[model samples]
Target chain A: MKTKVYNKQAFIALQSILVKEITRYFRIWIQTLLPPAITMTLYFVIFGQLIGSRVGLMEGVSYMEYITPGIIMMSVITNSYSNVASSFYSAKFQRNVEELLVAPVPTLFILLGYVFGGVSRGMITGVIVTLVASQFVELQINNWAIVCFVVILTSMMFATAGLVNAVFAKSFDDISIIPTFVLTPLTYLGGVFYSIKMLPEFWQNVSLANPVLYMVNAFRYGFLGVSDIPIENAIALIIFFIVGLFSIAYYLLAKGIGIRS
Target chain B: MKNKAIAISDLKKTYSNGFEALKGISFEVAEGDFIALLGPNGAGKSTTIGVICSLVNKTAGSVSVFGHSIDQHLEAAKRCIGLVPQEFNFSQFETCQQIVVNQAGYYGVPRHIALERAEVVLKQLDLWDKKDSQARMLSGGMKRRLMIARALMHEPKILILDEPTAGVDIEIRRTMWTFLRELNEQGTTIVLTTHYLEEAEQLCRNIAIIDHGTIVENTSMKDLLSRLDIETFILDVDSVPNELPKLENVEYRIRDESTIEIDVPKEKALNQVFESLTEKGIRVLSMRNKSNRLEELFVQLTERAQVVDREQKNEN
Candidate 1:
C-alpha cells in the first residue's frame, strides 16, 4: 500500500530492468561478450595484417588504419542491434515481458531500460573490438567528444531500431531475419572496407543512401580526423534517425502493439 | 463508507481478430473481501484481469482500483494491484530470489528493501531453500508459489490470481488456500478465478459466476447458495431397503448395497426424511453433499446462459 513518487518509481523500474538485462548477458559472458572479441580479432588479423599488407592506402591512411573505425563501428552496430532485438524478443517469447507490462512502470521507461541495456552491450563490444584493433595498428583518437558522441548515438540508434524490429517481430525467426538480411548487408556495404568515393557514380549515390555509411564515416572522422562525408551531416543524420526510431518505438509501446495483445 | 478495492464497469474486449470476448460486464469487490470470479475457459476472466493490469487493451470500459482510474492515474491504480497470471510468466533462467526482488524493484522498492522483501516472501512461500535455483528447475507447484511470492513482494492492496492453483497437487493447493486465507484475514482483497469450485466454496465469502462474457450471478456466498432450488445428498445406510423410500418433494435412489442418493428440494426438511427412515428401522450412518454448492449453482447458471444464447441465436 506504499507508493513512491512517480520519478522515483520510474528510476527504480528502469534500474531493475537494466540490472536484469545486464545480469543476463553478463552471466553468459562466454556467449555474449566473448564472441565479438574473437570475431573482431579475426577481422584485425585478416583485414589489418594479411589484406592491408597487399592493399595500398585508400583514404590517405594504411588500409589497416582506415578500416579500424569501420570495423569497430560494425561491431557496435551489430552488437547494439542484436542485443536489443534478441533480448526483447526472448522476453516476449518467454512471456516474462508481462512482468513489466503489469507493473507500475511507464512505457517510456521500459523502452529506455531495454535500449540502455543494448547500449551497454554495444559499448562493451566496441571497446573489445578497439582493443583487438590496437593490437595490429597504431591507434589515436582525434576528437574525444565526437568519438564518444558518435559511438553512443550510433548504439542508441541501432538499439532503438532493434526495439522497433522486436516490437513487430512475431517469432524467434522474425528477430533474426532483419539482422541478417537488412543489417548485415547495410553494415558491409556501409563502406567498412573501401571508401565510397572509389565506387562508380551510381553506386556512390546508392552508398550515400545507406545510413550506416554516415555512422561509419562519422566514426572514422572521430578516430582518424578523416571522413568521406561532413561530420556535421553525419551527426545530424544520426540524431534524426535516433529521434525518428525512438518516436516510432515509443508510439508502438504506447499502443501496446506486440507486447500487449 | 467502506472503499471498494476494485470497480469495473461496462467492460468489453474485442480482439484484433474481431472476437468479442467480453461483452459488457460490471462488478465491484469490496475492500478486505475474498471473492471468486468463477467461469469456464474463454469466459473473459483472464481478459478482465488483463485489462485491469493493462496487459491487454480494452476496446471499451473503465477499470479503477481504489478510486484511481487506470487511464488518468495508471501508476496509482497499478500500485494497488498484484496480478498472478494463469501461466508461468517469469523468466525461467532467473533465480527464485532474483525474480521476486526484481519484481519489487519494478514497484520502486529500493534494492535493499526489495531484497529483504524477496527473502521474506520466498521463505513464507517455503521457497527460500530454492532461492538460488533457476525457476525452470522448480516443480510446477513450486513455480506457482514463486509467482505468488513475486506478486506479494510489493504487497499491493488487491491481489488478482488467475487460476493460480491450476496443475497443482491437492495438498499444495490446500496449503495455498490456507496461505491466501491468512492473507485475506490480514485485509488483502483477493479476487481469484479458479476452476476448482471447492476452493471457491471454502475460501471466498463472495462469488461471481461469469458465462459467455457476462456475469450471470454476483452475490455473497450465502445468497448465491440460497438461490439453489435443490441439493442432492449421498447417505450411507446401515441396512439396504429393498424398495427405495418414498418421500414428498424428494427423489431417492440406491447407489449400492450400503449407499443411497437423495435429492432434497428446498421445501423438504432433512429431519423429516430421517424420521421416516428411522420409523422404517433404517439408520443413516453418514451424509455428504453430492457436490459443492457453488459447483451446482455454477453449472445451472452456465447452462441457463447457453440456453438463452441458443434461443437468441435461433431468433436471429
Candidate 2:
C-alpha cells in the first residue's frame, strides 16, 4: 500500500511537470509549434520539390521520397532538443525550477517529466512536418514498427541531450550555443540530404562517426526499405546514446548542478 | 518533551568561494511552535532554510524533519516542509491559480483536490480576484501572498517563510499577520525570518538570533525580552524645560524644548518618571519606545557577537 501510494504520487508529480511544459509551448504556438511547420514546409518546397527535380534518382526512389523521412527526423530532433533546452533553462533563469527542487518529487521523475514533455513536442512537430511533406510527395511506410521505434528513440535521445545542455547552461547564450554550433552542423552533415554511399570511402567513414547519421539512416530505412548503413547498427548506436545521455542528465539533476548552490 | 518538527545539528555550509554561510549551527523547533529565526543580512538564516528545503547543499551537517533525516529520507523530509523563499520565485508568466495548483501537484496532490485547495488558499489570501491574472501583473503584496498560498497548498507540517512581508504596506502586512496567526492557532508550525523585528516579536513564540554564521541566542520570546536590562522611551512634553529633570536610576537627555529621551531600567516604573516630571513642571504628553524593543535587543546581541568574533580573530 505504501509503495502504491508513492508510485501514484510520483506519477502525479510527473504529470504536473509534463502538463506545465506542454502548456508553456502551446501557449506560444506562434513561437514553438508554428515555426517548425513553416520551416519544414519551406524545406519541402525548396529542397524536396525545387531542388529534387534537378538532382533525381540518387536512391532507388525519387529524391523527394528519399529525403522525406530524413526531413521529418530533422524536425523531431531540432524541436525536441530546443524545447527542453529553452524551457528548462527558462525555468532556471526565472528561478522557478525551485518549485520542483523543493518538492517531494524524485529527481528521476523530474527528469522524465521534462524529457517526455520534449518528446511530446517533437512527435507533434514531426507529424505536422510529415503531413506537410505528404502534400508534396507520397510517403511509403516499409516498416511501421521500425519507424515508430526509431522516431520515439531518436526524440528521447535528443530530449535527454537537451536536458544535459540545460543543466550546464549558465546563460541564454549558453543554451543556443550548442544548437547553433554543434547540433545544426551535425544535423546537416548527417544523411539528411544525401546518402553516405555517394561519398568517398574516407568521407563515408567520417560521416559514420556522426550519431545523427545513424538516426536519419534508420528513420529512412523505415520508410524507404533501404539504408546506407545496417538498420541494426543504427538502432544499437541510438540506444547507446540514449542510455549515456539519460544517465548524464539524471546525474546532473541529482547533484543539483547549475540549479542549486 | 514536545515532538520536534525540525532538528538541525552542526549544520555547516561553505560555498565554493570559501564563504561560510553556516558554521556548525544547531537548533530545534518544537512541533506547532511559531519561531522566528532572526538574523541580519548574510547571517546564514536563508542558508539554513535552504539546506532544510534541500535547495542548497551543505558542506557538513545533519537535518531531520520529524525524525526523518535529509540524507536518508530526503523525500519524506521534503514532504514535511513548505518554503516561501525571500525572492519572488514563481514563474512570472503563469497565472496565480496555475502557480498555486502546480505547486500542489508537485507535492502529489490530485488536480481536483489541488483546485479545491487552491480556491480556499487564494481566497483566504484575498487573491481569488486576481487568480486569472498573470503573476507579473499582481502587486508586490499580492505576489508575496501568492507565494504563501502556493506554499500552503500542500498543507505542509511546517511553513518556513523568509521575509514574507518585506515591502508590504501596513494594512496588507496586518492582514497577513492575522492570517498567519490564525494558521498558527490551527496547529501549523511556522518558522519565519524577517527584518521587521516587530513582526517577529508579535508573531513568534520563540526566537533564535544568528550572527556570523552561528546561533547567538535561542530562547522563548518572553524570556529573551525579559533579559533586556533597559528600555528607552521618547517622551513628548507640552512645554520646554531649560534643564532636564534628574531622577534616581533614570537617565534623561533633552532632545529639544518639547521632547526628552529617557532610559528606564526594568525595575523602574513609568509612574515614578511621570511624578518626577510633574514635580519639575514638565508635562508629559505622550511616550513611545524609541525603537522596537526586539530591534534594540537584536542590535545589541549582534553587535556583541561581532565584537567577540573580532576578538577571536585578533587572538588567532
Candidate 3:
C-alpha cells in the first residue's frame, strides 16, 4: 500500500509509549505509587520522630530532614527499579515484547521506552512522598536542579538495571527476588534512616561499598547542600551507572537475550 | 544480489544446548515470489523467520534480504524484511494504530509519515474501525490482522508471516489471504510458514518442506505435484457387484466400511474403466481421488524418513 507518510509519527509513537507507561502506573496507583508513600510515612513516624528523639542528629540537620532525602531517594530507587523490572517482565511474560523487538526500532529507543517508563513512575512517587514528608518537618531544596537531576538520573539508572533484571529473569519469583533479597536490604542499610557517621570507623569504611549510599547522600546533598560522600563522585557515578546499565540493556536487547528465544 | 528478493544460503542454527534447529538450509525467494515454508511443529519454521529477522542469533550460515547481508548491514537488511510473529505480542495497552506506527518508527520513518502509513495499512487490513481499540480488546482474528497491518507499516520489500492465519476461522482466514495476495501482487515478496498444507497448495507457487531441522524438499509447486505420481480416481455407480471386474492401471481398496479406493495410472483413462464396469453392469458406488497428491506424498516421505530414523536409532 503506497500509504501517505506522516513524518511526525515518531513523536507520536514515543508519546504513545510514554502515555501507556504513565497510564499503567496510574491505573494501578494503589499498588505502584501509593504503597511506597505509605511506607515512607511510616518511616517518618517511627524512624524519624521516634528513633531520632533518642539517636539525635548529624551534620547539623535534624534527623527528619537528613533522612528525608534518603527516603525520597529510596522511593526513586525502588519505584524506578520495580517499575521497569515488572513492566518489562510482564511484557516478556505476555510475549508482547516480541512485537517491538521485530520492528526496525533502534536499540536505544526501545531501551529508552522501558527505561523512561520506570523514570515516570519513580519520579511520580518520589514527588508525592516528598510532599508527604513536608507535612511533618521543615524541608529545604538547596538545589532544585540537582534534586531533579539525581532523581531523574537515579531513576534512569535503576530502570535500566531493572530492564536487565527483566531480561535475565525467568519467572515472577525472579522479578521479586531482586527487590526483596537485594534491593530492600541495600536501601535500608544504605543509610536511609541513619548517617554513616553513626557507624563505627570500620563499618563506615565498608559502607562505601554500597552504591545506594552514594545515591542517597547525593540526593540528600541536593536537598540540604551536604553529603557524607563526595557530591562530584555521586554525580559521576550516577552517569557511570546510567551509561553502564543502558549499554548492558542495549546489548541484551540487541542480542535478544530472553525475548527472542 | 541477482534479482533475488530474499536468499537464505546454507542457513544453520544450533542452540546453545547443542540441538540443531536448522541444518544448513538453503533457498532463494525471487522478487515478487510467494513461497510457502511448510513444516510440522518443532520443525524450525519459527527459527528460520527468527534468524532472518535477526531475533535468533545464528550459529552459522548467512541470510540476505534484498541483496543486503543481514550480518554486514543489519539495519538496512532488517528495514527490507518485516516479520509478523505467530504469537499475539503487541503491547496490550497500545491501541492498534500505535503498534503499527511505532513499527514504522523503527525503520526511521518520522512520526507524521508513520501515522499516514499506519492509517492506510490498518484500513487495508480491515482494522481501521478498531484503530483506536487497545490490542487486548480486539478479538483473536482481528488481533492477527493487526499484526499483519503492523508488519506492513514500513512497506517492507520482504514480508514474513509465521502462521499468519493459524487460529482464525476459515472465512476470516480466506479474507486475510485475499488481502495478502493483493499485497503480494504489489511486488512484495511474501514468505509464509504455515501448517495448512491445503492453503500452502493453493497460495504458494513454490514450497519448501522442513523436517527435523533440515530442508527435506524444495521445489516449484508444479514440479512438486508432478513428482506426486501416485494417481487416484473415483468411480460412481449404484453398488459393487459380487463378481469383481478387473481394470488396467486401477487398484481398489475398501474405504468408509463400504466405499473403495481406486488408484489409476497415467496410461489408463476413466472411460475404459467405465466401459469395463458397464460390461458387467456392476453397480458402482460414488468415488473421487482421495485428495491432492501432496498430502499422500508428504506422508510417504516423512514416514519413510521416520522409519529410516527409527531403524538407525535401533542400530545405534
Best candidate according to TM-score: 2
Tell the DockQ for candidate 3: 0.40
Q: Is candidate 1 or 2 superior in lDDT? A: 2
Which 10 residues in a row give candidate 3 chain A its minimum summed lDDT?
Answer: A4-13
Which pairs clash in model 1? Answer: none
Q: Residue B232's C-alpha lDDT in candidate 1?
A: 93
- The regions of model 3 sitting more than 4 angstroms off are A1-20, A45-59, B233-237, B256-258, B280-286, B304-316
Estimate, for each residue in B63-92, the C-alpha lDDT of model 1 and write its tens digit: 999999998999889999999999999999
Q: How do the residues A84-196 of candidate 2 rate in per-residue lDDT, one tens digit apiece?
A: 99999999999999999999998889999999999999999999999899899888999999999999999999999999999899899998999999999999999899998
Docking class of 1: high
Candidate 3 overall lDDT versus native: 0.83
TM-score of each: 0.96, 0.98, 0.90
Off by over 4 Å in 1: A1-6, B236-241, B266-286
Off by over 4 Å in 2: A1-6
Residue B27, model 2: lDDT of 96
Per-structure clash totals for the candidates: 0, 0, 17
* TM-score ranking from best candidate downward: 2, 1, 3
Whole-model Cα lDDT of every candidate shown, in order: 0.92, 0.94, 0.83
**What's the C-alpha lDDT at position B94 in model 2?**
93
